[model samples]
Target: MDKKNIKKVVLAYSGGLDTSIIIPWLKENYNNCEVIAVAADVGQGSGELEGLEEKAKKTGASKLYIADLKKQFVEDYIWETLKADAVYENKYLLGTSFARPLIAKRLVEIAQAEGADAICHGCTGKGNDQVRFELSIKAFAPNMPIIAPWREWNIQSRDEEIDYAEAHNIPLKITRETNYSKDKNLWHLSHEGLDLEDPANEPQYNKPGFLELGVSPEQAPDKPTYVTIHFEKGVPVSLDGQKLCAVDLLSQLNKLGGENGVGLADIVENRLVGMKSRGVYETPGGTILYHAHNKLEEICLDKDTYHYKQGIGEKFAELVYDGKWFTPLREALSAFVDSTQGTVTGDVKLKLYKGNIIDAGVTSPYSLYDEEIATFSADDVYDQSDADGFINLFGLPLKVQALKKLKLGK
Candidate 1:
């Protein structure tokens, strides 16, 4: 891909620090090419999107396209991951991990629609997002050329990028003191960099201007907050007694869960890029939903299926974390997950106290928990004499080995 031949380039713009400077960088490096900035709105809130068009144009973008992908993001990507019960490294809810592919897919669509010569992104070379975006791009448009400025440009650090931005006269909302790298969507808000880079430093959740979603557990209310989530075939369809849309349900949960300090995680996780990175995630709504869903599955699914699905959940997590959402294996695993969810319709009541989620009750029409047979008192369903034959057959090998050893004891 020659630079001179590239006439137009479509950029996955977020109006953040890296992307704010990338608009000008693209134009200068590509002979003043027509840079079309495309921002995907996956419920990062209006605050992030406010005045974005003006900012893009001011930074030398020929045009800006903001795609409203909130519904699709939750319904398609978030729900699928939720149904699969995927959790990366036993901690990360994959708020940022799964978002890249959806954003990148939209970028490819816009690039092809606009007849652009190349696609560009602001993902750093060392991070997992670069791989995620590039892999999705390759899956969609195999031959399309990609331009990653962080890898191509000579800027070595965020400080250098800031210097470049200042030199280019780009007005930024953040300075060095406040420039903690963050990624936020409807599901979660992640904080990394600055003091958070070191594993020893504890997260300043109680500090002002540190936490955006919820307070620390120490600040949570003394009384526990009870929440009832209704699931229909594995997907949450209602909160309390009211049925709501996916986005609305999640939004309401976020408000409730945030108020009670339900979801705050500090993890030093292994990145797909081969290094351990520390990040603090605030996922109030998602945490509540995951807990409720698991509780529902406990009663609905049989023991064998429930245990087997745990391994599937783990694999599903790895695949999503590694940015393999568009792959065949993930699709097959999702099919299996969906099959298991046929009986997952139920209502789960939870007690949220500080950072803990306690199960209050779980009820499902398809529940296999037979209280009559499982009762300690005498019951006609399970005969007491049946256990004698069952135990003998079950322990036949052990009994035979013991008898042989006794007979050979000269």
Candidate 2:
């Protein structure tokens, strides 16, 4: 809050209206201190980053640092969460929740490299991203000073933000009428605000810029489309027998999945800040990956390990959603998840039609299912007489309790 003490600050800039305004606001408030903008390119889109460097400087930033984090974002953050089966509240695949830490990490790196006195972010006080960004900054650099303009500044609403941008001559990708809050990456595209403010209102998916990834189920094709994905060590390696890079695989699936109305969820989730918020999330590629990965685990994991890992998945989701990615517990849970995935190598084929992910086929070399032992037909692998002694001991406690009650009947 002390402007005189702060000399130079590094900012996490997105070239959006909020961040664009913060650069000038920081300079005006902090005794005209220098502001270096750090923007992490986590595959939002090429359009979002096209003129970001020039825009940052034009908005009064000393310089712009664009960290190309697309590959790292998919491989390190997304894949790790997928392996743990970490889905927040059984629906959200944690699209934005996992992205903030990666962005904040680079912010800290730039701040440390530049030796700035403080770090700044454009996150509002109400959203979960503020927690995700600040907790990550603290985890990496505990002593780092974080300047959150939303929590400190006088600006209250998005309309006021647009007015401020207009008064300050800041160029934005959005305008007042068409403006809707969106966060895009290689994984998903999330949309909020507008008619979405009311839970009773139905989503206008046919509206322009409403569904970025794909069409709704009502608009999808009548014919079904099938996709086959191969995985090795629990991470998807290829699609339909074509080996592509992590980014390309997701891109291919996003295209295919989007066409078939694969993934779209209208969720009003509980925010980390205590209030509930509604958003329409489009995660085409992630939905396919989740199904493929979970099906592979079905044949690969034992009953005990498979059942136990389900609970671990819930806890893992909480840790990541709460922005505890850098904690030791996440690392330790990842170890357990990785250990269970040793035999999780296989292919999962599914039919995508009208928002249905129907199973087409599943195969694995390391499968534990034995047809001879499991079949009800005549087989030498499982002896019928062997279960007689096993059943006696298993039901001994129940049988003893019944006999004791019979003898002591009132």
TM-score of decoy 2? 0.96
Q: Using lDDT, give the best candidate's number.
A: 1
Against the reference, the lDDT scores of all candidates come to 0.92, 0.91
Candidate 2 residue pairs in backbone clash: none
Name every residue pair that clashes in candidate 1: none
lDDT of 2 at 379: 88
lDDT of 2 by residue, 1-410 (tens): 56787889999988987898999999899999999999888888888989999999988888999899999999999999999999999999999999999999998998999989999999899998889999999999999989999999899999999999999989888988777788889999998887887889898887766898998888899999989999999999998899999999999999988988888999999999899999999999999999889999999999999999999999999988998999999999999999999999999999999887999989999999888989989988888998999999999999999999999992
Worst 10 residues of 2 by lDDT: 203-212
Q: Could you tell me the TM-score of candidate 1? A: 0.97
Candidate 1's displacement at residue 259, Å, is 0.7
Expressed as tens digits, the lDDT of each residue in 1-410 for candidate 1 is 79998999999999989999999899889999999999999988999999999999999998999999989999999999999889988888999988999999999999999999999999998899999999999999999999999989999988888898899998887899988999999999999999999999999989988888888888889999998999999999998899999999999998888888889999999999999999999999999999899888888888899999999999999998898989999999999999999889989999988888899999989988899989998788988888999999999999999999999993
Model 2 residue 163 distance off true place after TM-score fit, in angstroms: 1.5
